[model samples]
Target chain A: MHEATLAANVLKIVSRAAAGKENRVARITVSVGELAGVMPAALIFAFNALKKETPLDRADLILIKEPVTACCDDCGTDYQPGPFPYHCPACGSRSFRITGGEEVRVKSMELKKEI
Target chain B: MCKTDHNHLEDIDLDCLVQEEDLRHSDRLKAAFRAAGVRGIGLLGSPGSGKTTLLEHLVPELMKKRRVAVIEGDLATDNDARRIQAAGAPAVELNTDGACHLDASMVETAFAELPEPKPELLLIENVGNLVCPVDFPVGEEIRLAVISAAEGEDKPLKYPAAVLRTEGVIITKTDLAPYVRVNPDKMVAYVRDMNPHSRVFLAHMDAAGKLVTEAADGGCSLEDWLLG
Candidate 1:
């Protein structure tokens, strides 16, 4: 769905990073948060579908799925809640805020250097 | 070539390089609108969730106080935009073609086409899809997720991302609750439970065909919430 747009963005960045370089991109690692509303499989499918004949054609998209982490404001305890009924496990407080699992970003790229 | 040079590999630390550019388009649009003192809201919901109907009622009421404009996002046709225009607001239609959601770039292009002296408030009616739109931020001050009563009560729990990400939730089609066997109260309760920070409202049509929305208990009115 929206993964196509995300893939396009990734390619744009990879192209810019590879600008003026003779290396071929081998792999691209991206971190997708569980709460980021992006499906990893769809993103990879989009990357494969749209990267043809481009610098990213040979690049393998590596997705790192990050779990949701909630931090309790009162007790300063960080914990990962289950898929449902989010609450601080230690303090039984719902005042905790999600500290992680809300970002989708390219972390790094592996390139094959030319001799 | 030397054996060592043939197998050489380099790892570049991009580390959020794409995200740096991701904020460029939306951030620029937000700054430009903010400088002009124009506030914006991204309205999202499932297809046939009464979004356009709600807008048909809200735009005129809102116009009584502040100038309003709408940016309608759809897969094809300018029907929603035309409807909003008929409702008496300056409207722009962005046909995403095949995209599931409207991105910041589309919003930038549509905003540029809007006439000078932008309206005080802009409501971007995002393409009718809950999942994809939740991930894309279109430089709006507030995000409103609409779920109709007919869509079932467990939608908020099922689509947690949409509920959690929105600043407000509009539960529309309350009049159809009985026919659809949905308890509007329970739906509102579920939405509140999922996201305690979001303001939830129940919208229904009155006898005279006016859209009336009442904020759930402990929630503020849409006008007050949006204006503030």
Candidate 2:
């Protein structure tokens, strides 16, 4: 999608947490789920381009990419789904719900000092 | 802020989503709609997917029973809003000015711009993009993507987020299906595979710009799903 806009949002989130350049951000770790529909490389590219001389300029972006997992509707077996044609492995049923890989969150941030 | 000495780095428990601000705006907009008794429906798709054309037909039909208003999102044109107005619905146009998607704050402001007494059903036509718009929700009770058969059947599989996030999928332009050799059933199957939760409908616009409901699940029409 528009990772530039999302990058700006990332800065907004980190900026608010950093209290406007007060905190020296060492690293910004975020969870980028596969099913969250965000490309990590694009997000990192935009983030780096935007973070230029800001407080977070030297901050390394650590992305925890989550795999797509689903739970069978009938059997409740959680499994990671592969390319299309997804179905429960145990029951062999197409009736499964996606349980993971849809989250895009900022889990924590590493700072030079305790905030 | 919890400073765990394991890494010698001060860690702060952010514990929040990247879309936190958008979700806040969306939650507020949703609460406002709830208080106003408005069922917000967002129609999204690529440009020329007949979103406005479908509204041109459905607006009048919906207004016959309840008050209906439309908010049109486009890059630089009020043409869609004007068309919706011609169809007898008070319309507001939101030009994103080259932005890919309409955020909740923009939609919240547009909702406030509609006519007084408030519409029972508010239709929001998002900017013509399949990827970004699905992620940026506009406080719609139901969101549906309009994919024309002219674009072929590969869209649902190519863009899984659109099918997964939206509650319904509408395939338009079935009249030109044979000409394009793109089977609409295959499109429906792919949509079902990606998201079995989506309600699928087949639609086509006539030469007069009238929307023809070519196929729909029994008693599960878009009208029934939204208005009910």
Q: How well is candidate 1 docked (DockQ)?
A: 0.66
Candidate 1, CAPRI quality class derived from DockQ: medium
DockQ numbers for every candidate?
Answer: 0.66, 0.68
Worst 10-residue lDDT window, candidate 2 chain A: A14-23
**How far off is each candidate at the interface, as Cα RMSD in Å?**
2.0, 1.7
- Scored on chain A only, each candidate's TM-score is 0.90, 0.84
**B-chain TM-score of model 2:** 0.94
Q: Write the per-residue lDDT of candidate 1 for residues A6-103, one digit (tens) a residue.
A: 89889988888888877888889999988888888999999999999986788999999888888876798999988656778888776656788878
Binned by DockQ into CAPRI classes (incorrect, acceptable, medium, high), candidate 2 is medium
CA-lDDT, candidates in order:
0.85, 0.85
For model 2, how does the per-residue alpha-carbon lDDT over B1-228 read when each residue is reduced to its tens digit? 676575566788897788877878887898889888998998999998889889999998888888999999999989999999998999999998999899899988888889897899999999999888987888888899999999887988888888888889999998899999999989988988888667889998679867777435555667767685
- Compared with the real two-chain complex, what DockQ does model 2 have? 0.68
Off by over 4 Å in 1: A113-115, B1-7, B17-19
User: Best by DockQ, which number?
Assistant: 2
